[model samples]
Target chain A: MQPLVLYVLDLAADGAFERCVRRVEARDAVLSVTDLSATRGDGVFETVVVIDGTPQALEEHLDRFARSAALLDLPEPRRDLWRHAVLTAAADLGALRPRAAIKFVLSRGDEAGDGAGTGWALGFAPSAPPAAPPAPIDVVLLDRGYRHDVAQTSPWLLQGAKTLSYAVNMAALREARRRGAQDVVFVSSDGFVLEGPTSTLIARIDGAYVTPPTDLGILPGTTQADVFAGLRAWGEQVATRRLSVPDLLGADAVWLCSSTRGAAAVRSIDGTPFTVDDALTARLRDHLDARKK
Target chain B: MQPLVLYVLDLAADGAFERCVRRVEARDAVLSVTDLSATRGDGVFETVVVIDGTPQALEEHLDRFARSAALLDLPEPRRDLWRHAVLTAAADLGALRPRAAIKFVLSRGDEAGDGAGTGWALGFAPSAPPAAPPAPIDVVLLDRGYRHDVAQTSPWLLQGAKTLSYAVNMAALREARRRGAQDVVFVSSDGFVLEGPTSTLIARIDGAYVTPPTDLGILPGTTQADVFAGLRAWGEQVATRRLSVPDLLGADAVWLCSSTRGAAAVRSIDGTPFTVDDALTARLRDHLDARKK
Candidate 1:
């Protein structure tokens, strides 16, 4: 296995990347207890998968990163610096394994320090590939306790931004596991189907790939976008729309899409069995793995 | 100003504290990039005020910390060990200043490490006391995006627990500032008054002290509890009930209360003026500062 790689980005007063970015030992403690990232989860992060040394969907990830920062009112991330860091880390880890992931983080800095924010990139390859045959996931629907229009009605609640404050998301996942499921799909209070705790939900309904719209206070799905593009190229229909539980139940197939893990078929939701399309799952995996960018 | 103080708590396999608590320099980096506290905000925390070499409301803070951990499904914090650590840090910090605070944290440990969790205690005194006459705070009522009964209907949302995922709270404070206010009192989606982003709301209504019930998905305020006890001793009425914006607008007086800052009178809500009860504010502060436990 390849050793983990880390780079600490030096940020300027205005939060732009400075010239000196230091490569640090991954085992060293690199964060102060007072850093808002550690103390208050006041940060934003993006994880990009690298296939054969190429960081997949790199620009889209960066665009979403900047968007998240803007939503959180943090400084704009320097794209050039972040790109360099991702590519450098990918190359280092991709040499040891064909598959790797790089996570880049930007925080609101120390509580008592100068105003410059804290930023870092970390790259590592999984110790082993997932189980053979890519087991389908069982998911339970959990209440997210927010209305579908909360992102517009109350921006301070930070519904759409992928901030570091993910404790509730983690708790929901644990709740799913307790109920004999491996994953969760959050439902808004007003009966709209939202995204997964860590992935995007795509349901094939009436012969079209449908995902909940981002305006429903959920993340803009990057992997789902790539999958949609691939589906479009293959002459299949795709869409962004408001999804409800009934719509999901009536779908032909359902899957969760994420960067590193690609797509995983949903075998059951709340114990209602849904047939997994093995051939389609395999095709999507191959498409994702063959990304050149 | 005195230098900061820090202690790293060692944990056993079952997440109980071990005897080898090491005091490290406050400036030293003490957390890994992969600690769940930083990566996912998967943790709980509590802050206790230390006055004149004594930690105030120590047991209550510890109880709340343990309750928060239970909510997050983290291990029960060993009370004896935490008490000792808080006292040790508080003593070190209290020797330098009459008013100081100690924050104790427990995280779900490094993502790649053994299952044992990470824990720390940090003590520091403000460089200077707050402005004389204790300027009252002008607050705006912001939507919390959760219904008042969220804590009952959706425990996985982790509403009442004092978790480290405070980015929304911080953002709400920023929104208050953007709207030309100094602080915020979060209101529920279904028209109920909640707590502040970082403080509890206490209103004097109809000649009685009233606060929202904890069942409304809010933290049970430690300072407010103490103030209630003091008020009871003074032969004043105190009650916990659901509050509304109109209730606040019509209240005789209002205040935001926290452990370290004691209490700050609310001078206004939104743009409407509310006269500050200087005598009551001073009395509450003195009553809080006089705690010996």
Candidate 2:
């Protein structure tokens, strides 16, 4: 069946440009598109760096995706089959324009049946974080639509998976817009600053870099891990620690790191502006570039 | 567009039932179907009791659905619109067995949106838990999955929605089956017995019944609340308190309350068999029946 609607999107909210085709599935269509907003969010996703028409970190991303699937007790996707699919999708976008992002989603196919025919879809989402941390990205704190804290026993399923239950992410982004910010940072109801809706947060405090502890259940970001490792090797004191908004607002520097955006320095928090250390920002950017190449 | 395949079944793991469906989406001339599994393990779900073919608690269910949606940071299903759709779907069921079970799933609909129109399928799976909890049912104490204690935060996104992310629930059920039991009970990593995968747990201790506090982030069971209120009016002491497996195993009686099952008494814990108190079960069941009518 031809999809009900298909459109080429010149740009997605993430600022990454891409062409997308949408198909609407009937309520009872067994083999059609399933609406993702209704079920418990259970799925794993991978974002790979596409540079010069090749996917970097494909293997690592796949590994993390599988780990996420296992963590959520989801049936692991066939490695070779999915890898081939990923390669095909990336290759489809021939002649990459210097840098691009590839997103892979592996979800439980459909909830209608016994959850068989595990569904898999791939979409090319805009992946680049601001080439340079937005000269000053505005951020707001709001009630997270879901729990981002890694330390609590959550009743809702799909805690850490790159699940499609991303309505909250979009909502948070919308909230950011409402608050006159390009993005929003999440704080636990208890007052501890967690992470951004989409990126792992790193802050410079007293000349040291810090992130939330991984055991807190934050998504173990590939980019965050790499940056932490690089910073540590460079004799920089980097660590993961609990942080509050006061801590972040008072930090020497703040940045958001993700697969697409290596590291974006935060310019303001709650409308309070901060100075971006040009030397430190350039060093982080250079580190990301060197690693990418 | 006619859905290629349709099914209605309860969200329980059946070792003997292996049914697969090729869920198809109708798009003009393009018919695409994805295979789905038959497990309801990791997702959160809501069971709205329908009366006269019209779903009662539509707004409440939507409210809970939104709360559940917020827990997972799920995308908004447009409360009124989705509520209407759910009512319509329940209405289509045509008063199946009077107290109809209307379940809406918000899982990662499909995970292959590599822009080929994959990822996320909203599905309405209608089914029932066992007609009733068996009197004097057996219980087991098992630790099969990661203990999501308060010390650890969920690593994934939207850790608190009622999506089809139910892998652990399935595991607990399987564990019960392995021990010759019909239903499984979960305890928190901290040894505090949580609710059953599908039911709210209550125990009568020293002539007073108590349930876990909702602040622990457990699913708020509608039936449990009704029963609690009813039991209280009758001068029975009912309170919300923290309970452990040992406490439940030693209580006068333990019960599992859900939308369809109403209430059922546990006869034993782990491998130790306990006697079913028909008197108490009947009392609670009668109270529920009175409230339902």
Question: Global lDDT of each model?
Answer: 0.88, 0.57
Taking the true A–B contacts (Cα pairs closer than 8 Å), what share appears in each candidate? 0.87, 0.10
Evaluate model 2: give its lDDT: 0.57
* Model 1, runs deviating above 4 Å: A1-3, A13-18, B1-3, B13-18
Give lDDT tens digits, candidate 2, residues B205-257.
Answer: 88888888765446677788888887888888888878877787778777888
- Residue A96, candidate 1: how far off, in angstroms? 2.1
How far does residue B182 in candidate 1 sit from its true spot (Å)?
0.8
DockQ of each: 0.70, 0.11
Q: After superposition, how far is residue B74 of candidate 2 from its true place, in Å?
A: 9.1
Docking class of 1: medium
- In terms of lDDT, the poorest run of 10 residues in model 2 chain B is B31-40
Candidate 1 residue A252 C-alpha distance from true site, Å = 1.3
TM-score for all predictions? 0.97, 0.65
lDDT of 2 at B282: 80
**Which 10-residue span in candidate 1 chain A carries the lowest summed lDDT?**
A12-21
